[model samples]
Target: MKRLLKQSILVLAMAGMAGCTTLGPDYQPPEVDVPQQWQSSLTEASTVADREWWKLFQDPVLDELIQQALENNRDLRIAAARILEYAARVDIARAGLYPNLGYGADVARTQSSRNTLGAPPDGVGRVGSNYHAALSVGWELDFWGRIQRSTEAARANLLAEEYGRRALVLSLVSSVATAYIELLSLDRQLEIARDTLKRRAENVDLFRVQFEGGVVSELEVAQARAEYETTAILIPAIEQQISITEYNLSLLLGRNPGPVARHASIAQLVLPQVPGDIPSQVLLQRPDILQAEQDLVAANALIGVARAAYFPSISLTGLLGLASAQLSTLLEGASGIWNAGAALAGPIFSGGELDARLRVSEAVQQQLLQKYLVTIQRAFSEVDKALISSQKLREVLAASQRQVKALKDYNKYARERYDEGYVSYIEVLDAERRLFDAELEYTRRQGNSYVALVAIYRAMGGSWVDAAEAVADKVDFPPQDAPESRHWWEYPPATRPAAQNQP
Candidate 1:
C-alpha cells in the first residue's frame, strides 16, 4: 500500500511537470487576399437582409412551398438527425467531467472431489461458498483539459453542421422562387407566341387570297407561309419546357410532378431591388463563412488535444458500490466493499511518436487555417459577383423591354403599309419575325433577372441574425413541438390558396 501510494504521488508530480516544452508550434489563422472594398453597387447598405427576404417578395405560395421543403427535404431531415447525434455526443463529453459508478452481486453453491491437494475431512474437498460483491467508480482526470478541449471541438463541429443545414434551407428557398419566376416568364412568352401566331395566320390567309387573284407574287405567299410555321413551331417546344420546369419544381417540393400556383405574371411581380448591404454584412451572416470559422476553431482545439498528448495523464479507479455473492447478504450488512486507486502515466521513450503526433496535428491545423481563408475569399467573390450580375442583368432586361416596344410599333406600321399595297407580303412577314424575336429576347431577360436575384440572396447566406438571442429563439423549439411542423405536408389547412389570382 505504501509503495502504491508513493508511486501514485510520483506519477501525479510527473504529470504536473511533464513536457515543460510543447512539441508543436502554436497555431495562427491564415490571412486572405480580399479587396478592401466591394466592386459593385454595395455602397448604400441596409439592415433589411436580416428579415426573411423571400417573404419581402410577397409571394405567399412561394413562402409556403419553401416552408414545406425545409421540413420535408430528405437531406435536411438527415442533417437535423445528425445534429441530435452530435447532441448525444456532447452529453457523453460532458459526462467525462464526472466519475462513473457501477454495482454487482452474485450467489453460489459449490462441491469438490476428495482427491484435491488440500482435502476437507469429508472426501469432497474445498467445498465452501460465501457471498461477496463490490461497487466500482472510475474517471480519467482531465488535468490538462484534453477532454474539455475535445468537447469544445465537438461542439464547434456541431455548429458547423447546423450552419450547413441552414445554408441548404437558404438554397431551397432561392431555388423555388427562381423556378416559380421563370415559370411566370414562360407563361408571358407563351402568350406572346400565341398572339404572334394569330397575326401570322391572318397574313397567311390574306396572302392566299391575293395569290389566287394574282395580286401578290408566289414568293410573297411562300415567305408568309414560312413565317407562320416558324412562329407556330416554338409554341410546342415552349410548352414542353414549361412541363419540365414544373416537374423540376415538384421535386424541390419533395413530391411528384404537378402544377404549382403563384400570385403574379412576370410583368406584374415586383422585381426585388438588391438592398445595397455592404460586404462586411456577409462576414457575419453567411452560413458557409460561419461554418468555415467553426471548422477553424475545431482544428485549433485539436492542436490543444495533441499538445496535451505530450503531458503525463493522471486517473482514478475506485470501487464504491454495493455487491454480494448471496442475494440475502447483498445489503444486510456493511459487507459490500469499496476500493479506489489513483493512477499517473506519461510518455517515456516513445521513440518520438508523441512528438511526431504533435507535428501532424499542427500541420493539420495549418491546412485548416489556409482552407478557412480560402473559403472567406471565395465567399466574398461570390457576393461581389452576384451583386454585379444582378445589376447588369436588370439593365439588359430593361433594354430588351424597350427594344420589344420599338419592334411592336414598327410591326404596326408595316402591317398598315401591306394593307395599302405599299409593300409586299414579304415585308409584313419580316416585321412579324422581328417583333417575335424581340419579345422572346425580352422574356428570356426577365427570366434571367429573377434567377440572378435568387442567386444573390443565396450567396449572402440564410437570414442574417445580428444577435445571439435571435439564434437562441430560432433554435429553442421544444422537442415535442419541433420546427418540423412547418414541413410542406403540414401546412395550415385554413391558409388561402397560394396563387388564386394568378394562373
Candidate 2:
C-alpha cells in the first residue's frame, strides 16, 4: 500500500509538471493608430513634459503649492492607499501557489449512557477524556494553471492600481497649477477694477466742477457717477470669486477654508513656452492609458482562470499528529496517527455554470479591450486639443496686448481732447471703459494660456515629482556617455526605450 502511494505521488508530480501550460491567450498590447505629426505648427523640441513642468513658470510660491497638493491632496492619498490594498491582494493570490500549514490542539471530555454504549458497567455511564494535537497542510496543485492565472491577474491589478496613482498625481499637479494661475489672474482683475474705479471717481469730480463752471451739463456728472459705481460693483464680485477660489484650493490641500499665500502677480508670471516637436506616440506613456492597459491585461488573465476551471483541480491534504486520552501521551509514538488524501474535482455537471462563467470572463476581457482603446484615443485627442489651444491662445493673447496698448493711447488722447474742449467727456469715458475691459480680457487670456499648457503637460503624462527624488534630497551625476536626456514622452519611435521590466 505504501509503495503504491509513493508511486501515485510520483505520477502526480510528473503530471503536474507536464501540465504547466497556461490556459488563456497571452497578453499583447493593442495596436493603436498614431499620428505622424501634430496638426499645430509648433516646432518639435526637447519635451519639458516629464521634468518638473510647472517649474517652467518660474514661480516659487506656485511650486510650493503644487508640492503641498501632491503631499496632502485627499484624492491622491486615496489613490496611494488603493495601491497598498491591491499590493496586499497580490500577496493573497500568490499565496495560493504554495501549501497552507496549520497547527491545532484540542482537549475534550465525553460521556455515553450505558444503554447506548455496549451496556457498559451494568447500566453505568461511560466517560472518556481525549487530547489531540496535529499539524495540517493542504495545497492545490496548479496542474491546470488556475492558481497561476489567478496570480497573474492579481499582479496585473496591482500594477493597474499603481498606474492609477500616477495618473492621480499627474492630475493633481495640473489642477494646483491651474488654480494658482487663475487666482493670480483674478487678483490682477480686481486690481484693475479698483484702479479704474479711482480714475472714474476723479472723472466725476471733474464733471461736477465743469458743470458748476457752466462748461458741462448736469447730465455729464450723472454719467460719470454711474460709471464709477459700475467699476465699484465689479470689485466686490471679484473679491467674492477670489474667496471661493481660495476655499477650493484649501480643500485640495486637505485643509479648511483659508487664504493661500501668493508671491507673483499675474503680470509677473510668464507662460511657459510649449515644447516644439512632440511625438504622438507619447500618448501611450500616459498613466491613465497605462492603467487601462493593465486592466485589460488583468481581464485577459481572468479568461484563462475561467478556462482552467474546465480542467480537473488536484489538491492534496494531510494531517501529521498524535491523539490520546491522556495529555502527556499525545506526543508519544504509540499515540501517533497520520492521514493523507488527494482529491480530483472536475466539472462533470454544473448546469452550464462553468460554461457561462467562461463566457462572462471572455465578455469582460472584450469590454476592457475596447475601453483601453478608447482611453488611448481620448488621450491623443486631449493632446491635440491642447496643442491647438496653446497656439490659438497665444495669438489671442498677443492681439489682446496690442488692443490694451492701443486703448491706453486712445484713452490718453481722448482725455487731452476733452480738456482742450476738442471732444465731449463721453469720448474720454468710452475710451477708458474700453481700456479697462481690454486689460481684464488680456489678463484672462494669459490665464487661459497657462491653463492650456497645464493640460498639455497632463495629457502627455508629465511628472513633476520623481519617485527617487521624493525619497532622497541629493541629485545624482548624469552618465557621461548618456544621450541628451529626453522626457519619457519625447523619444521618437526609432529611439523609444522600453520601461524597466517588472517581476
Candidate 3:
C-alpha cells in the first residue's frame, strides 16, 4: 500500500509539472503591396513640419477652434470609452491563467415529516443542524495552452481597439482643421466683396456727376449703380456661408450652432510642407493599419484555441474544509475533511463540432487577413490621393493668382477707357465681374491647398508612435512567404495594452 501510494503521488506530480504541448497553427501577417515612396511634382519640404499646419497661415483663431473641438468632441469621448471597455476584456482574459479559489460556509437546520421509504422523520427525533465550511479551488491546467492562446488573443484585441480609438481621434482632428480653414476662406471672401462694394459705390458717385454734367449718359449712371449693388449682394451670400460653416464647425466640436472665434486671413494663412518620409513608415504609425493587424492577430490566436480542443483538457479541483453534524464539534480536529480530484476530458464524438470549429477559426483568420490587406491598400490609396490632390491644388492656385492679377489689370484699363469715353458701361461691368470672380476663385483654391496639406498629414500617419515588432510577442516566429499554414511558437508571451498608445 505504501509503494502504491508513492507511485500515485509520483504520477500526479509528473502530470502537474509536465509541459503541455499547444496544438495550433502559427499566425502570419497578410500580404499587401505598398509603394516605397510617393512620386509628385511638389517639393518635399520636410523641415517645415515643425509647426502645426494651421499655424503656417499664422491664424491663431483657427488654431484655437481646433483645440476646442479636440477637447469637447463627444464622438472622441465615446471612442475613448470603447477603448476602456476592451481594456477590461483584456484583464478578464488574463485572469484565466490564475486559479479560482472560493471560500464557502453553510449552516442549516432541517425538519422532515415521517419517513417515506428510506427517508428520515422529524417525528422520530428533532431535525439535525449541520455546519459546513470549505475553501474550494479549481484550476484548469494550461497544459495545452488553450487559455494562454486565448489570453494572447485578448491582448491583441485590446491593442486593436486602442488603435481604432486613435483613428477616430485622427478623423476628428482633420474635420476640425478642415472646417476652420473653410471658415477663414469665407471670411476672406466677405472682405473681398465688401471692398469691391465700396469701390463700386465710389464709381457710382463719380458716374452720377459725369452724367449730370452731360459727360456721360443715364445708361452709364444706371450701370454704375447696378455694379455697386451686384457687389453688395455678394456680401450677404458670403455672410450666409460663414454662418453655415461656423455652425458646422460648432457641431464638430460637439456644440450647438454658435459663433466660433478665430483670427486669420487666406493671405495670412501658412501652407504646410510635405514631409519626405517614405510611405512605408506610415504603416508603422497609422492607427487603422495597427487595428487591422491586431484583428488578424486575434483571429490567429483563436485558431490555437480551437486546435487545442482536439487534445484532452487537464484540470484540478479540490476542497479542504471542516464539517460536523453537531454544532459543538464543527471546528474541532475530529471534523476535518479534505478532497482532491483531477480530470482529463476529450470528446469522443461530437458530430464534427471540433472539426467545424477548427475550420471556422481558420476561415475567419483568412477573412481578417484579406481585410488587413485591404486596409493597407486603403492607406496607400489615401496617401496617393492626397499627394495628387495637393499637387493639383497648388497648380490651380498658381493659375488663379495669375488670373487675379490679369483681371485687376483689365479692370484698371476698363476704368480708364470709360473715363476717356473710349468704352461703354457694359465693358466696365464685364471687367469688374471678371475681377471679382477671379479673386473669389483664387481665395478658394488657397484654402483648398491648405486642406490638401491636412489630408497629406493624415495619410502620412500624423506623428503617433507605436511599439510592435511584427505581430507575435511570446516566441520569435520564423519568416514565411505568405499567410498560409505556418508554425506556432512565433508569438511572444509579453503584451502591451492598447491604452499605452494614447497621448
Candidate 4:
C-alpha cells in the first residue's frame, strides 16, 4: 500500500506538469498608425515635457496649488484607493495557484438507551466519548492553466488601475493649473476694468467743467456720464466671475469656498517655449492610452481563463487525523486515521453556459481592443489640436499686443485733438471705447494662451509630481531647466510603436 501511494504521488506530479499548458490566444497590442511628424509645422525643439511640465511655468503659486491638489483632491484619493483594492484582488487570484490547508479538532460525548439494541439486563444506558483532530488540505491542479490565467488577468487589472491613477494625477495637475491661470486672468481683467472706469470718471468731470466754462455742450457731459456708467457696470460683472472662479479653484484644492492666495499677475507670467519637434510617437506615454492597453491585456487573459473551463478540472483532497473513543489513546499510532483522493469534473451538459462564457470573454476582448485603438487615436488628436491652438494663439496674442499699443497712441492723440477743438467729443469717446475693449481682449488672450499651454502639457503626459518623492516628502517647486534634444523613442515603453505611418 505504501508503494501504491508513492506511485500515485508520482502520477499526480506528472499529470500536473502535463496540465501546465496555457490555452487561448496570447496578447498582442493592437496596431495603430502614428504620424512621423505633426501636421502643423511647429518648431522641432527637444521636449522638456517629460519633466514636470508645470515647473516650466516657474510660478510658485501655481506650483503650490498643484501640490495641494495632488495631496488633497478627493477624486485622486479614490483612484489611489482603487489601486489598493485591485492589488488585493491580484493577491486573491494568486492564492488560487497554491493549496489550502486547515486544522480542526473536536471532543464529544454521547448516550444511548440500553433497550434500543441487544440490551443488557443490568445496564440502563450506554455512554461513550470521542476525540478527533485533523489536518486537511485541498488543491485544484491547474492543468488547463485557469488559475494562472486568472492571476494574469488580475495582475493586468492592477496595472490598469495604477495607470488610471496616474492619468487622474495628470488631469488633476492640468485642472489646477488651468484654474489658477483663469483666476489670474480674471484678476487682470478686473484691474483693467477699474482703471478704465477711473479714466471715464475723470473724463466726465472734465466734460462738466468744459460745459460750465461754455467750451463744451451739456450733451457732451451727458455722453461722458453714460460712458462712465457703462465702464462702472463692468466691475461688478468681472468681480462676480472672479468670485466664481475662486470657488471653483478652492474645490480643486479640496477645500471649502475661500479666497485663493496668489503672488503673480497675469502679465507677470511668462509663457514657456513650446517643446519643439515632438515626435508623433510621444503620445504612447499618455497614461490613458497605457491604461487602455492594460485593460485590453486583462480582457485577453480572461479569454484564456474562460477557455480553460472547457477542459476537466482536477482537484486533490487529503485528511490526516487521530480519532479515539478514549482521549488517552488519541495520540497513539493505533488511533491514527488518514484518507486521500482525487476528483475530476467536466461539463457534460450545462445548457451552453460554458460556451456562452467563452464567447463573452472573446467579445469583451475585442471590444477592449477597439477601445485601445480609439484611445491612441484620441491622444494623437489632442496633441495635434494643442499644437495648432498654441501656434495660432501666439499669433493672436502678438496682434493683440500691437493693437493695444496702437490704441494707446490713438487715445492720446484723440484726447489732445479734442482739447485743441480739432475733433468732436464723439472722436474721443470712440477712441476710449475702442481702447477699453482692446485692453480686455488682450488680458483674455493672455489667459487663453496660458490655458493652451496647460492643455499641451496635459496632452503630452508630463508629470509634475515625482512618484517616489511624493510618497516620501512634500513636493518641491523648483524651476526646471530645458532638457537636451533627444529622440521621442527615449520615453518609457508604456505603449508599442504604431504599425503604420499616418498619411
Q: State residue 116's C-alpha deviation in candidate 4, in Å.
A: 4.7
Residue pairs clashing in model 4 are 44-276, 44-277, 45-276, 45-277
The per-model lDDT (C-alpha) reads 0.69, 0.78, 0.73, 0.79
Model 1 alpha-carbon miss at residue 109, Å: 3.0
For candidate 3, the C-alpha RMSD (Å) to the true structure equals 8.2
Clashing pairs in 2: 43-276, 43-277, 44-276, 44-277, 45-276, 45-277
In candidate 2, residue 210 scores what lDDT?
83
Give the runs in model 1 whose Cα sits over 4 Å from its true position. 1-36, 42-47, 121-126, 277-282, 321-336, 345-356, 462-503
**Candidate 1, 157-264: lDDT as tens digits:** 776776666666666677878888889889988999999899889978988998999987888888888888998999999898899988888888778788877777
Better structure of 3 and 4 per TM-score: 4
TM-score of 2: 0.89
Provide the lDDT at 166 for model 3.
62
* Per-residue alpha-carbon lDDT of candidate 4 for residues 168-196, written as tens digits (9 for 90 to 100): 77788888899899989999999999988
TM accuracy, model 1: 0.82
Candidate 3 global CA lDDT score:
0.73
Worst window of 10 by summed lDDT in candidate 3: 466-475
Model 1 lowest lDDT segment of ten: 487-496
**C-alpha TM-scores of all predictions:** 0.82, 0.89, 0.83, 0.89
Clashes of each: 8, 6, 11, 4
Q: Could you give candidate 3's per-residue lDDT for residues 60-148 as a string of tens digits? A: 77666666665666775565456556655766876877668789999999865564665675456757788999877777788888987
lDDT string for model 2 (1-503, tens) is: 34544554564455446646679888988888887877767753456776788877889998888777766677765655565566567778879877777899999999877656465685454788899988777778887678888988887887787677667667777788888999999999999998889888988988888899998898899999999998998999999999999999888877889999999997888777786566677668777888899999999999999999889988887776779988888777788777778899888899999999999999999999999989988888888888889888988999999999999999999989988989988898899889998999999998898898888887777444344124111111122443466333222112235673453
